[model samples]
Target: MATGNETQVREFIFLGFFSLPNNPVVLFLAFLAAYLAIVTGNLMILVLVLVDSCLHSPMYFFLSHLSCLDICISTVILPKILVNFLRRRNTISYKQCLAQTFFLIGFAGCEPALMAVMAYDRYAAICRPLHYSLLMSKRMCIYLASAAWVWGFLDSAIHAALASQLSFCGVNEIPHIFCDVPPLLKIACSDTSVNELANHITSLFVGLFPVLFILLSYVCILASVLRIRSGSSRRKAFSTCTSHVIVVILCLGNGFLNYNRPSAGYSLEIDTLVSAMFCIVAPVLNPLIYSLRNKEVKGAFRKVLNKWTG
Candidate 1:
């Protein structure tokens, strides 16, 4: 039995901000500016981390990876958005849509685990400063970072595989800006019980476990910081963790709010705005957050600037 929805839905048409004002030029300019800023900001961080010996520590290494992840996540979708604005075409092929969805899921999943690793790094630095070098050795950092990225890709593969098996025999219109698990699942005409269940399960792998680990590490970190006798020493110790905490909150708060929720609250406009926050806005903010808040990064930026100018 061939359902009409299954046979006809070969492509997806995105109704992107179409109902807002119907102005593609304004949208194109805005998105172009954002895309340029995100690329330049993240690229500066990447280049500095690579070139500066002062930033060769485990923290900066992980921060570089975080920068790379932000670049990747934002890049995966922004080009298409830019194309849509310029060409006035918001259509994505079935295969391309799935590929986009896969990369997005993989990168999004990697953040929590990477953040957890960073939390542990901070914990090791403050809670066990004497053992920081031995505990967070070069090999160990590579292993942890590699595991996070691999797990993210594997998790994304599983979800994409399952979603591919689904029969999207209904309308090919995705309510939001891009192709995503929940949005894709929303349009499926076939049984999505299994797919949705898989979506739920894989998300825990992506978000919950790592978040718990990060929280646990922070608790230990906070306890250790409290024991510092001098006010300046305490502030110095606490300052290192503060930016990470801010980033963690921004990442996890926006992330879990949408991905971790049930489908009952799904609104098209709301989802678009929220997705833009984490996907588009967060990446742009990450580099600024790291550079402005951390003295090391700021100092390194000054060194680089002076060296180049000289």
Candidate 2:
């Protein structure tokens, strides 16, 4: 419990769906399906990346990490949402809330950086093919992937540390679904100037900087792709990038909307939907995007299936 001059809040009530319909069973079933799909889809990608010889490349190596992050980001938020759908009240203990916030923000922060790394992987493959092996060596991949995860959780640790210092003072109603720094800050009765400042400053590094990196990487990639004179070569090069590009757009777009929501004008339902898009829909779609777009992934899936059946 946070100690302050007033009574401390030990738990928080989620107002995520308070403004929506009164059907718990329907909501429960719906979210359960989403969670299952998220796990199954991302897990398939991860397993394929591990087992398929054809997928043992820098691109797929980074993709496997992206799949893991997608699963983690969804798992951090969705299970709690599913459980709350069954309960009479949508609530989380203060400690649980903080833990959720930490992991959710950690995984969420990790994804864009990871995507940027994946873009760099693509950039190296297409733009610097002569040095692709050296640029994305096994050790290099491990280091870049580790850096993304560390960057995310380190940033998350800072936010979680700041959040822990906040004195709720009996005000614990979080306006959104899961525990996040923004909603938590909204309910904090103490002076939140420091938290807000940290949030904005970190948003630059954690959000904007990586996004800029991705755009720059893609710009270089597009230029390189265009320089290839053969139409077939251009198509093949573009095909390799389509899946990553779509996944990046979906994940980053939903995330941007989720985090940058305006302070006052939106309704609770809108808030809930936006968070769901980020936490639920994006994860579920990523594997499908790759599977459908990438011939390699589909062939790997077929190969795995044949081994299992035949």
Candidate 3:
């Protein structure tokens, strides 16, 4: 160990999936399969949203963005993970590590905010139907989506800057699969109090705030649904948003669990597993969750399928 914080940080060694058996080839193959699934699923969602005129609405628009974010988040994680596992190559340059941290957090931040936007769209669609068109016009949707992406980038950029500037004397092995903020902070020799504070502040706004907003939106939606006199209308309203609700729960729940923790409670094995869920499994399931559960999406997908196969 280089004492006294003398050495400048250069690179990091990721102790990837340390709990897994010592079988890099098998691990790599599994990760590759998962990565392909994530890509194919999200891409399918994107295509359906684009081609199906029936889906040319605010909900599908938001979903298209969500699918894009899923693809981005997974791409940032899985390829590198698959490659490293294959070659048993865990070393990442300082630049590469910081870039990974920046992109993944950026996309992760976007997800909750995007979900909140989708929630608002649902609220308008259910709670205020007369005003839905006026309230969620194309321009308004653009604004909300842009706001989500911008805030996410800004929040993550702040964290990335702080983490990259920290002094690292010697310890370079990252205890997790990726360069997430908590683990990166763990190995830093410099003081991280301010950095931790920044992380918590950003995490609060982008993560917790959006979750609360989504919950509040859904509560209002539930009340509106109850007020609807027709049973069929209520069922249709609920069906429209069920997939999004599930997606919100998975994305925000994992985010809250992963980031809103003290370093004192850090566990490498647990972190790796959680990262796997958030970075890989969630993205792969998003399209399936939305398509398989929603009647409209299934109908649209079938049309698209028949057009190709017929």
TM-score of each: 0.95, 0.98, 0.95
Worst 10 residues of 3 by lDDT: 1-10
Candidate with the larger lDDT of 2 and 3:
2
Q: After superposition, how far is residue 88 of candidate 2 from its true place, in Å?
A: 1.9
Off-target runs (Cα >4 Å) in candidate 3 are 1-5, 261-267
Question: Model 3: which residue pairs collide?
Answer: none
Model 3 TM-score is 0.95
For model 3, residues 1-310, the per-residue Cα lDDT tens digits are: 2346378667889885766778888888888899889889989989999999999999999999999998999889888888787667777888888899999889999998999999999999989999999999999999999999998999989998888778778778988888888888888888899998997688789887888999899999999899989999999999888888888888877777777655566577777787788787778888999988987899999999999999
**Candidate number achieving the greatest TM-score relative to the actual structure:** 2
Query: Model 1 misses residue 182 by how many Å?
Result: 0.4
Residue 12, candidate 3: Cα error in Å is 0.4
Cα lDDT tens digits for candidate 2, 201-275: 999999999999999999999999999999999999998898899989999998999999799999889998898
Q: Cα RMSDs of all predictions?
A: 1.8, 0.9, 1.9
CA-lDDT, candidates in order: 0.86, 0.92, 0.87
After TM-score superposition, the amount by which residue 185's alpha carbon in candidate 2 deviates from its true location, in angstroms, is 0.8
